[model samples]
Each structure stands twice: as C-alpha cells, then as structure tokens.
Target: MNMQVWASLFGVVLGGLLSYLAQFTTVRVAGRNEERRQAAQRAEARRAERLELLREFVTIAQEGIRVAEERDQAPDWAAAGTPEWFAAGRSVIDRLWVAERMIQILFPPRLYRLARTYASAVDHVLWRLPDQIAAEGSMWHHLRDPQHEFLEAARTELGAHP
Candidate 1:
C-alpha cells in the first residue's frame, strides 16, 4: 500500500476507537447517576410509608384511651354494668391489640417491642378486669398512673398527644 493510504487508514481506525470509548464512558456515567436517583426515590417512598403507619398506630392508641375514659365516666345506671358496656370497653382493648399487631407488620420487632409493654398492660387489664372488677369493684385507680405514663411515652415517641 502507498504510505499516504496506510497513514489514512490508521487515522480512521484510531478515531473510530476513540469515539467508541467516549460513548461508552458517557453511557456508564449516566447509568450510574440514574441508579443513584432511583435508589433515593425508593428510600423516600419507604420513609413516607413508615410515617403513615406510625400515624395509624397512634390513632388507634388514642381511640383506646378515649373509650376507657368514656367507660369510666358512665353512671352505674347509665349502662355501666351491662354487657354492651363491657363490649365497648373490650373493643377499645381489641383495637389496641390490633394496632400492636399492625405495628409488628409495619416495623421491626425492636421498635414494636418499645410500644408493646404498654399495649400488653392495657390488654391484660381489659381481658382480666371484667371478672376481677365485677367481684371487687372497678379498680379505677390502677389505671391512672399507667395511663399517664403511656400517654407521655407515646407523645415522646410519636411527637403528638396520641
């Protein structure tokens, strides 16, 4: 081949290789950036989901406390000792248990256990109280301290009065 023709072919081949390398590097960098962006988006979505679950858990807890308050306030003749009253009271306890279970589904066991102590206490009271109180009268005083502590803990943990 002529020297000029050989030099021309070398230049074309070298230019093609350089162009291919540039394109490859550009694609790799773009792919990495896109992957990082997608990872960040997924993390944000998971955080939002966690917050929603916490809100639901807090709401359920508040409802239980409210039912307890209502039950405590009812008059002896105003449906205090009836089966419906117990059912209403029991429902509040039931809801708390459900919330605890839901939390287990939504979060790690360690976090759920943090709230479980209070939940278990409330649950025990609800289940074991009816027969005990029926014989011994309402142990209303027993509820006061635990309720206060639970409310405080809940507020501190959830950043709300729930």
Candidate 2:
C-alpha cells in the first residue's frame, strides 16, 4: 500500500479503540451510581422498619402507663420483671439493635449505647416498682434524653434527619 493509505488506516483503528474505551467507561460509571442508589434505598427501608418497631415500644409504653395507673389494682411490677415484659421489650430493642448493626456494623456506636442505656433504665425502673411510679415521670425524663441524643447522633452519622 501507499504511505498515506497506511497512515489513514492506522488513524481509523486508533479512533475506534478510543471510542470503545469511552463507552465502556461510561457504562462502568453508570453502574456504580446505580449501585449507590440501590444501597440508599435499602438503608431507607431498614430505617422504616426500625422506626415501626420503635413505635410498637411507644404503644406498649402508653399501655403500660395505663396499666400502672389502674385504681383497682397496683402496677404489675411482677409481670414487668418477668420473662414476658422482657420478651416484649426485647422484641423492640433487638430490632433497633439489628437495624443499627446493619447500617455500619461498627462505625457508629451511639445506637448501641443508647439502647443499653434505656435497657438499664427500664431495668432500674422495673426494680423500683410502684415506688418509682411517683418517679416514673423522672425515669421517663431520663429515657427521653438518651433517645434524643441517639437520634441526633444517627442523623449526623447517616446525613439524614429523623
């Protein structure tokens, strides 16, 4: 072949290779973005589930308050310390633990510490009984602080507001 013809053929092959590489790079970048989008969605679903579980505890707390206030009978401290209430409370607390674990496993320790704090509080309240009933308001006050701190920490860690 002539020199000019050979050079033209080499140019075309180089252009074709460059075009293929550009398209492949675009595809790879798009895939990574999609994966991140899906991960965000999964995290959202997990958060929703965790919040639902927390709502269950709130509902039980409301009922438990009513149970504590009955005029006919004293509060059921016996049941509170029993396996039953512990199981119910554990159900809610365990779900929160799992959800936090799923998020980073180890990065944020706030949730774990918060759960432990409340669990201990509940245990303390459980022991103090109808005596603590007068202090139930105080116990609940302490409970609220931990919950608020945990949520604020979670928002900071997750870059999302509760």
Candidate 3:
C-alpha cells in the first residue's frame, strides 16, 4: 500500500480502539456508582423503619406504664368487676399485646427476648397488684427493672443512644 494510505488506516484503527476503551471504562464506573447509591438508599430505608418501630414500641410501653400507675393509685378495695378497674386492666393488656407483637416483628432475637421478659414482668405485676395492694396497703414493691432493661436494649439495638 502507499505510505499515506497505510498511515490513514493505522489512525482509524487506533481511534476506534481508544473510543471503545473509553466507553467501556465509563460504563463500568457508572454501574459501580449506581450500585453504591442503591445500597445506600436501602440502608437508609432500613434505618428509618427501625426508628419508626422503636418509636411505636416505646409509646405503647409508656401507655401501659401509665395505666398500671393509675391502677396502683386506686383504692385497694376496688373490686375487679368495677368498670374503672376493668377498663384500666383491659387497656394495659391490650397495649402489652400490641407491644409484644411489635417486638416480635421488629427486634432481633436478643432484643426480642428482653422485651418479652419485660412484658412478662408487667403482666405479673398487673395480675398481682390488686391482691398485693389489699394485703400490703400499697403498690410500692414491684419488680419493674425489666422495663428499664428492655428500654435500654431497644435503644442500643436501634442505635439511638451510644
């Protein structure tokens, strides 16, 4: 071939190879960036879900505590059949049931166990409170430490505090 024709052919081939390499590199980098962005979005979504569950669980627990406290303040002789007593008891039980379900759904095994234990403690307290109040004349002595333990575990699991 003539010198100019050979040079022209070489230039064309070199240009095509460079263009292909540039396109390949761009596509690979863009794919990796997109993958990273998607992963980050998924992580954020999970964190938000966990936080929302924690908020709901805490609210239910607090409501249960309030009901229990109210029952404790009632007169010791208040019969269980009374409307006030029945309503308070029902409210506490329902709240605890919902909280337990939330824990089972949202918590890891360790945290779930902690929450269950706390629920059991609350249940025991509610069941025995009336008799204890009548006998002891007060509701000052109850095993409520499990509630704090559960709260601490939940907070830690949700990455809310330290």
Name the top TM-score candidate. Answer: 3
Per-model TM-score, in order, reads 0.68, 0.53, 0.77
| lDDT measured at residue 102 in model 2 versus the true structure, 0 to 100 | 45
lDDT of 1 by residue, 1-162 (tens): 699998999999999999999999999999999999999999879777767766666676666655655555556534654777678777777777777777777666666775576676555445444456467455345455555564565455544544
Please write out the lDDT profile of model 3 over residues 1-162, one tens digit for every residue.
Answer: 699998999999999999999999999999999999999999899888877876766676666656666667656535534687667767867777776877788668988888777777666556564666568543324435676787888778877788
lDDT values for all models: 0.66, 0.56, 0.72
User: Which runs of model 1 end up more than 4 angstroms from their true locations?
Assistant: 81-95, 124-162
Compute the lDDT of residue 23 as modeled in candidate 3.
Answer: 100
Q: Over the stretch 1-162, how does candidate 2's per-residue lDDT look in tens digits?
A: 698898999899999999999999999999999999999999888777656555544454434333323321445545445565555555644554454444334334666566455544544443455565565555566456655665566556555654
The C-alpha stretches of model 3 lying farther than 4 A from their native spots are 1-3, 76-81, 84-88, 133-143, 160-162
Best by lDDT: 3
Ranking by lDDT: 3, 1, 2
TM-score of 1: 0.68
RMSD of each: 5.0, 5.6, 3.1
Clashing pairs in 3: none
- How many residue pairs in model 1 have overlapping backbones? 0
User: What does candidate 3 score in Cα RMSD to the true structure?
Assistant: 3.1
The worst-scoring run of ten residues by lDDT in candidate 1 lies at 121-130
